[model samples]
Target: MKQPLKVAIVHDYLNQMGGAERVVGVLHRMFPEAPIYTTIADRRKLLPELQGADIRTTWMQSIPGILRRFKHFFWLYPFGVRSMDLRGYDLVISSSSAYAKGITVKGDTRHICYCHTPMRFAWDFATYMEGNEASPVLKAAARLLIKPLRWWDRATSARVHQLVANSTIVQERIQQHYGRSAPVIYPPVNVSRFEVSKEPPGDYLLVVSRLVSYKRIDLAVEACTRMGKRLIVIGDGPDRDRLKRLAGPTVQFLGRLPDGEVVRYMQHCEAFLFPGLEDFGITPLEINACGRPVVAYRGGGALDTVIPQVNGLFFSEQTVESLEHALRSLTHYAWDSAQIRKHAEQFSEEVFIRNLASLIEGQLSSRNPAARPAVPALAHKKKGAVL
Candidate 1:
């Protein structure tokens, strides 16, 4: 009799809900029995889908105030991840943007890492810290840690048996930073949760994202404020105060809202605004699912998802002038909401699960040829070619 594979999942941490965490949620659904290991988890911040997950935390979880100040302990993550006991799992899948990929595995246990990107702080300290408002002393301390962290990050890239990238830009980054070639797998978006609105699009523009400096929410805030366009900004982070100060009378900040409320905003907005570069921006697809177009900066993952004049339009530069031009150009473009929504459906949750499962089964078959027949016929399936 063929035995079932013992699979376990590893994530950098479950301290916040975002696109990466959503990817973890899809993974949990795919391998429901798989135990999830992480450095720490903040229960209050867990998404609804992850509320009942079998999450196992490391020693870092017990540290006082770790949940609130996790970023301060970045240096300890490699040690915490390395300390995990993953000896028995037949397959260990790590969803990492950082230390989760550094876990130790031995013997026949194969490790597959779904890398969101190389550690940004270590690899691109200047841009990662650009517009960051940390104390000078703290910034100095972080700068000192970058060189050693980069070394450790590069050294650990060799630990994984296979790597998966979320977008083409990230795939290029993996090859550039880690000397590894990874197949691109577009992450899942729950297209069904959104519906094409029956009502006509509203006059106001919308932005839904974590207000971080690197994300450049200020671009959206400033562009709208300068144009006297009504812009609604949702989500919150350290960059809120500065962004609010940049806002004019027409710009509104709604902070964090429920998913349903967010969808309501997406359904009625003139268009969704994605001003920052992302590994993969899921919110734009969510808005597209709501039958709306996006106006995004032309770079990073946006290159993969945004089909110019089809689903969304793009600005060439990250500057206020470029974005302002795109906003001005938006009024002249004729947008087809149904076509936009159709494009988003290509990156649905079902497609992601099918592609990922096929990849996993193919790897398993390659590892044990004798058990090939016992696996599903999907072993020959290819990664997502949607891009």
Candidate 2:
């Protein structure tokens, strides 16, 4: 009798989730029978499979209200990720925008990692360090964690047998920051859900994203106020209520919209606005798939996905002034629906599944042998600077 391949899927905290969750969702579709392992799965609200599926969680799972009350708890993720048991699994696949790839696997098990980035807070420390010097104690704590976090990131990344990144930007970050390389397998964009609307220019610009501090959605709201343009803000998070209060008369808050409705709005809108420094933004691709032009923050993943004066325009900074200039500049541009869709098709969910499947199959086929207890080590090296 032959043994079936036992697989374990690991991820970081499933609490303050966003694009990472979307990537995991597609991974779930691809490997439905695999057991999901994570630091915690917040039950307040989430994709049903995460809560209903066979799940293994760490210490954070015991804590309630993980979404609202877990500020000081992010420090637990690296240790929490270590708590997941992968003893008997033949293959371990990790979906990480953060620390999920750090899980320990059996010496005999093969590990494949799909990294979003090499842990944002640890690598992009400057973003979170501003104005953080409130006290000697707090400063001391940050000082203590910074070096350890960087050490942890680098140490665990080497444990991965192979890595696939969602964007070239992230692949470069992995190499520079983690001394690791990864192949780029772009995140899945479901082009089928979005149909091109032939409607003329609409009344307002639309921005759909989780309202995080880093998202910089407030810049768009401020720009709409100053420029006197209408803006529709969709999606909800910790920043939603505060953003609503700060918004001027021109901005409308539509909290936590469904994907279908968001696509419908995207097709009819004047343009879609994205203000974050994304690693690989799935939403911008979805908006372009809907045949609307994107106005994106001009750094990170947007550099790869958006071409100026084509499917989108890029603002130079995360400020109202830059966004206002970009929106004002949009009036002179022309776009072709076919070209936009063509650009988006390159990152469709189909391509993601096919590429990911091929990578996994290729690795397994090479690892397999007909008679073998006498096989040499199988090195799953990166094909094209895998990060």
Candidate 3:
């Protein structure tokens, strides 16, 4: 009998977990036996599926309230990532928004990286300088670190045998940040979870995110308040109170909802409003998969997922004024719910699993040309059985 595949997966910090962590969870589904490794894991607030998984982490997890001291971890992450025990796995799959791609791998093992974005602060420091969030001293330090980290980020690209990006936007980023080419495989959307239905329209629009300073939920609140539009902000973070103060009486806070409740709101909402520059906005895809159109900030993954009239409209700039214009213009056009769902179907979980299975098979087959893989026509089972 053939031996089962042995895979080791690595990621960056698993603290304050969000979409990228969910992507790792999806990978777990494909390789159920694979043990997960990362820099940090906060089990208290993590998804239930991740509870008992064999998640190995760096010594950073030993630090008390590591997330509160998160800024310090960045200084130690480089060394922490290099220290992982990756000596025995047949395959290494890294789901990275940061330095996990730089993990040390043996020459005999194959590697695949699903890059979320190439360590944004390290590679896109110039663009990030536009934000006034960081102090000048810290910005200067980040700028200084940029060149060296960029070199390391690029050096690691050659370590991976295959690269898959979440969107064309990230495909471009892969080229610009790492000088590497990667195929676009849109992240999986659980299309079946959302019920695409018409309902009594609420007075407010929604902005769902982690409420980080970079996410710029502040801009969304400011724009909606200034425009006299009602807004419903979901998800909580350090910026919640700050964002709430900026919003008007028309704004409501839903905090974080279960995956099911969020979808119910998505199905019944007037339209989903996604206002951040995400590596790939899986939430917007989830919203669209629910037959709701999105009003997205023009940059990032929105460029690939949203078509102006087909499913959603885009704001040219990531500013308050621009999003206001897009929000106002969105109501002028009508979007077909069925077409929106169809566009979303193209990025469903089934597609991701299929593509991943193909990529892994291709990698293993290339390693062993003498022994052919099972026929694709057999549907992963023995042939000559009734359909």
Candidate 4:
């Protein structure tokens, strides 16, 4: 039997329990022996699955309060990721939305990037700074930093042997920004965690997301408020306070809740409100898995999962009026919960792992021209498999 290829996994950071962290968790499970490299890590904030992993952090980890304020150290992350010694590893896989893909490795070693998006801040400078109420001084500083950061982002794209995008939008962004092509691999959703509802849907609208500005949770709050619709807002972040102030009496802010409770809300809600544009939004599918339809913005990743009058309804614009119209249409139409759950099964954890493992095996086979990988079916097992 051939020995397993020496592998190393790198992630941008380990401070949030978000979609990116979940991807890292799945990768860790697939490569249990490989150590995870990151710029900074706060074990207390990570998911339980990642808490016990051998997560090695760089010198930046020693910075005070970096756990809560790592974004302030953005300029240092490129250097921090590149400085890690990954020379001996046969393969380096960086699960990144940002600088993690800049990890330096020998020419002979394979490096695959599961790019969520080519550093959103670097590429979408105007959009990234839009919702922030940063002081003029901070804005000026960011404007100056973006130039060098853009150069660094473009320069580092050449390091990856292969690039895997999470959605078609991200795949297109990679080609447009990096001048590179990548396959689209939808992020995994733990479909088994949610069950189809036994009863009919509840009266309230549901918004389960980090209370952040760009996420456009404000649209949901404002729309539901104007319409006098009861909306349950779950999850918390820096924008929590401002969101609370914008919310009307009908909108209830639940902050963050345990996964089980979140699933419970998904099962019972009238429809899941996904107001933001995501590279590949996983929450909408998670809601679908619980047999709930979604009212989503008709752009970005929502286009991939939601079919008009199928799994969910989509609003053409990212404004309160558009979302309100979609909500009205959602109420008038009947939804098929079983079909929605079935649609979600395509993006399950099992499917993501199988497709990903197949890609790794293929890359390894090409490198070792002398011997082809044993499992050919692994590559062709599923249709609609991208990267």
Q: Which is the leading candidate under lDDT?
A: 1
Give the winner by TM-score: 1 or 4: 1
- Reference-based TM-score of each model: 0.93, 0.85, 0.87, 0.92
lDDT at position 386, candidate 4:
29
For 281-357, candidate 2 gives per-residue lDDT tens digits of 88888888877789999888998899888799999978888899999998897878768878888887777877886
The residue-by-residue lDDT of candidate 4 on 268-337, one tens digit each, is: 9999999998888999999999988999998898888888887899899999999999988986777888
Give each model's whole-structure lDDT.
Answer: 0.88, 0.78, 0.77, 0.86
- Candidate 3, which segments miss by more than 4 Å at Cα? 125-143, 257-261, 370-387
Question: Which pairs of residues collide in model 4?
Answer: 235-255
Q: How many backbone clashes does every candidate have?
A: 0, 5, 0, 1
Better of 1 and 3 by lDDT: 1
Alpha-carbon RMSD, each predicted model = 2.9, 5.1, 3.8, 3.1
Best by TM-score: 1
**Which regions of candidate 1 are displaced past 4 Å?**
126-134, 371-387
TM-score of 1: 0.93
**Better model by lDDT, 2 or 3?**
2
Whole-structure CA lDDT of model 3: 0.77
Order the candidate numbers by lDDT, best to worst.
Answer: 1, 4, 2, 3
Q: Where's the lowest-lDDT run of ten residues in candidate 3?
A: 378-387
lDDT (C-alpha) at residue 148 in model 1: 94
Q: Spell out the clash pairs found in candidate 1.
A: none
